[model samples]
Target: MSDLLERLRGRGWRMTAQRRVVAEVLDGDHVHLTADEVHARAVTRLPEISRATVYNTLGEMVTLGEVIEVATDGRAKRYDPNAHRPHQHLVCGRCGAIRDVHPAGDPLADLPDTERFGFTISNVEVTYRGICPNCATTA
Candidate 1:
């Protein structure tokens, strides 16, 4: 994510140490973490980092296209750093685990032309919800 940091720096983003730490926290971990979760982890590394700072940094990153937000439900939104790739998400219905997935077909094709009411369609996000293996085994 050094490249991302450099790009953000070139874009005139204030490279505060807190922001760098926040970026490192997201970059080092592959899992999708909610803002609260991210703040919790960041606190361990930099106790002075406030929740607002983390939230602001995350919002800026999202706006800059350096991150993506994934919502498994109506609850907290998780941040995904794998923004460079095009993929979908498979969410566990019972345990809330999320796995990145790649479907075989173009998802946009599934939206039949008849469904288009003359509006320009841009993108699609498909989330498949099911019981994960570990959760299934427990049940």
Candidate 2:
């Protein structure tokens, strides 16, 4: 079983066939796939699964804090299953490839007192954009 599946089961999540397939499709490293991409992959494993089911399952997972919905640049939102970890995203400027990057230090602590305008900060999102090695080699 995948980590996401294990976590879901630990949380007493109901494991339906459609939900299982969606979770299975999302199990992997560097897996940042859009809803359509997830639906397409799920169809390969279970042809009867519907797009609505995938979308709804994803929404529920996000609501449960089991998945992260990443919207990079105006493109379709991609779902990431690394919600339990503290990390940032590395985006490929050319192909829009996304990878989970664990960099040293805390971004939340980097903010100075004056930088904050009286609002208490709870979370910080940092995105690093660059041409990935694959894109650089092909260029």
Candidate 3:
């Protein structure tokens, strides 16, 4: 996403070739790539790109709100580029495939005030886990 790079530029992010490659790897619909995956892909374009550089670039992107992290199984975190949209994640418990899903109602509303515990409620993220079509067919 060139737009993302431009926005990062506007925010004074130094444009590096490695960061650009990483961003390109992240740009697309339903893209949920882990850091190792990102580094693997980025290495194809930037053979010199190190894992530390990729991690730093990802951290910067997250700080800039250009990417959101999803911990599907608490093992590895996936980076989502669709930060502007409000949605939840549907993860395949078997194959670990992830899909973005939109629910019909307000999920946060399900938590009534009684359960708020006197803290300010701001946002909600729901992760639905099940077998994906491919995984189901294979099984």
Top model number, lDDT: 2
TM-score of each: 0.91, 0.92, 0.94
- Give the Cα error of residue 124 in candidate 2, in Å: 0.9
| Per-model tally of clashing residue pairs | 0, 0, 0
Model 1: per-residue Cα lDDT over 1-139, one tens digit each: 4666776788899888888887877873357999999899889989999999999999999999988988888899999888888889999999999888988999888888899988799889999999999999999
Ranking by TM-score: 3, 2, 1
Model 1, total clashes: 0
lDDT of 2 by residue, 1-139 (tens): 6889888888998899899999999988788999999999999999999989999999999999999999877778899998888789999999998889998999888999999999899888889999999999999
- lDDT (10s digit) by residue, model 3, range 27-91: 88799999999999999998999999989999989998999988999898899998888999999
lDDT at 20, model 2: 90
Off by more than 4 A, model 1? 1-3, 28-30
Better of 2 and 3 by lDDT: 2
lDDT of each: 0.87, 0.91, 0.90
Worst 10 residues of 3 by lDDT: 1-10
